[model samples]
Target: MVKYVEGSFNEDYIQTLGVNFMDKKVQIKSTNITFLIWDLGGEKEFINMLPLVSNDAVAILFMFDLTRKSTLNSIKDWYRQVRGFNKSAIPFLVGTKYDEFVELDFQDQEEITQQALRFGKAMKLPVIFCSTSHSINVQKIFKVILAKAFGVKLVLDEIVNVGEPILVYK
Candidate 1:
């Protein structure tokens, strides 16, 4: 997402070790909004940084790796911890690595999709599947966040079919 907002992509992978910050200004529905992004590292050791990240946040992205189902299981714990600090923070269930996810077998894809949908429904969050490398549904994440935050209906259509990037927010 940092790359997407920055309008560039890097081939090399540099994992977030602790926390990183990036700011971007965008025009959505003719409204210019500035977004201050905090990229907290996703590691048990970095869980201590939750208070700093979750405090006063408008939205919380509970993201998991689509290729790794175990990551999805961790979402429950993360969401619970974040909710402790900010119950009103809008939550989003995000599945990353769609480029690799679509390459998996149909059964695997269906299983993951069903599980993600169930989890999203349970949390009452908008579910979105995206590939940062491919820029698929990357910008839509923030756009949906803004629309929901301001109670505005998005004009974009959602794609929910299997074997495709899923964007379910109704």
Candidate 2:
């Protein structure tokens, strides 16, 4: 993971490029399915530093607490910002706290879901609501992203076997 902190412009976050070794090594006869994952800054002040959104990104994962309607509502502006940056219409949407929503008011829940649906329709992207704390549908999120980005069909044969090894080409 490479951390980029362009402090002068109030933007700071980490970006990582790697392969999911848990799955087979792509079995590629020629090239690797390389990827770039940008874990962007969530701070309001840092939002401005995002580079122009474009198709270079495979997906954008917007995560927010399900118990906080305010936070959920805030995603719209962020979505616009991201959409503007991502001019190519790559897949993107909100990821809510699935389990945490049990504690939120019913009205808030409906509103959030409505907002999510509205945003999804407007952006032509699907909204994923899942919980990481309880490990609910966590793995599926990556699967959806992978399917959308690569247009490849994948099923869970088994958990991917990830190891630490650096490949060298002569």
Candidate 3:
């Protein structure tokens, strides 16, 4: 998961087998605010540690596989657990594996997208469809987190003029 956020695409990685959690201190490029990111595995054994890790979270991101409906259904349970720990934490619903999802039929794609939208609406959280393999919306997700955490307006410079130098002020 950290590799995904950091823009490393390795599809051959194996799934996590146990209740493992890792933390990394990352600096948001847009805001320059250092954030401690706790990547928790979604295993039953990790349920007990939710409160301990999420107590100081500014934002919580619940990601599910777009090609799997069951993963989407599990978001409710995850959201509930996170909210129990920190009601004030901003929540984000992320649909991953978008590269695979696009290969599905139009009807299937629309159905999954609609379902995800409904869940996001019901949870009152923003939804993002991303493909780490294709580097889609990966950075945007963190930018949204930074904006929400610090109440800052984010204007992403998607394209810069050749001669114009970009500057980031502290």
Candidate 4:
């Protein structure tokens, strides 16, 4: 999120081993909004904290590693748990590490992309593919979230293709 707010990428960001709290003020049109972000590593020990973050959330972003199919598979369980807490929260399905994902073979990329689209369609979640290291689609993700949360129409074209950074907002 530092990359989103500060416009500088950090190579030394460690994964959240536990809950981390953050907030950022952003302008959507003429409105000033402060977003409270709570991060919890998807560890068994921290599953109990899910409700704290999920409850009353404007949106819930479920992210997976593009290079790891196992990470994608685990999202279903996380989705289910989060839904039990706040069903009205707009859900976003994101595939991270697209910079490394593009280095994979063509067939693997196609498979992951198709699987992510299928999951996004099934869950009615906006699917976004991004790379934090390269700052791809990072700001767009928040824009989409704001547009959805505020019931504003987003006019960005969806990128639908294999082996490309997807920003499916439909």
Return the lDDT, model 2, position 25. Answer: 26
- Candidate order by lDDT, decreasing, is 4, 1, 3, 2
**Candidate 2 vs. true structure, TM-score:** 0.63
lDDT of 4 by residue, 36-125 (tens): 877788776889999888998999889899999888889999999999999999999999999999999999999999999999999999
lDDT of 3 by residue, 6-104 (tens): 547667866655434554456555434555667666666878778866898888888788889889888899898888889998888888877888788
Higher-ranked by TM-score: 3 or 4: 4
TM-score against native, each model: 0.95, 0.63, 0.80, 0.96
lDDT of 4: 0.90
Alpha-carbon lDDT, every model: 0.89, 0.52, 0.71, 0.90
Off by over 4 Å in 4: none
- lDDT-superior candidate, 1 or 2: 1
Residue-level lDDT of model 2, residues 116-148, one tens digit each, is 666666667666665555555554566666666
The per-candidate count of clashes, in order, stands at 0, 5, 0, 0
The worst-scoring run of ten residues by lDDT in candidate 3 lies at 161-170
lDDT of 3 at 32: 46
- Stretches of candidate 2 off by over 4 Å are 1-34, 52-55, 153-170
Better of 1 and 4 by TM-score: 4
Which of candidates 1 and 4 is the stronger one according to lDDT? 4
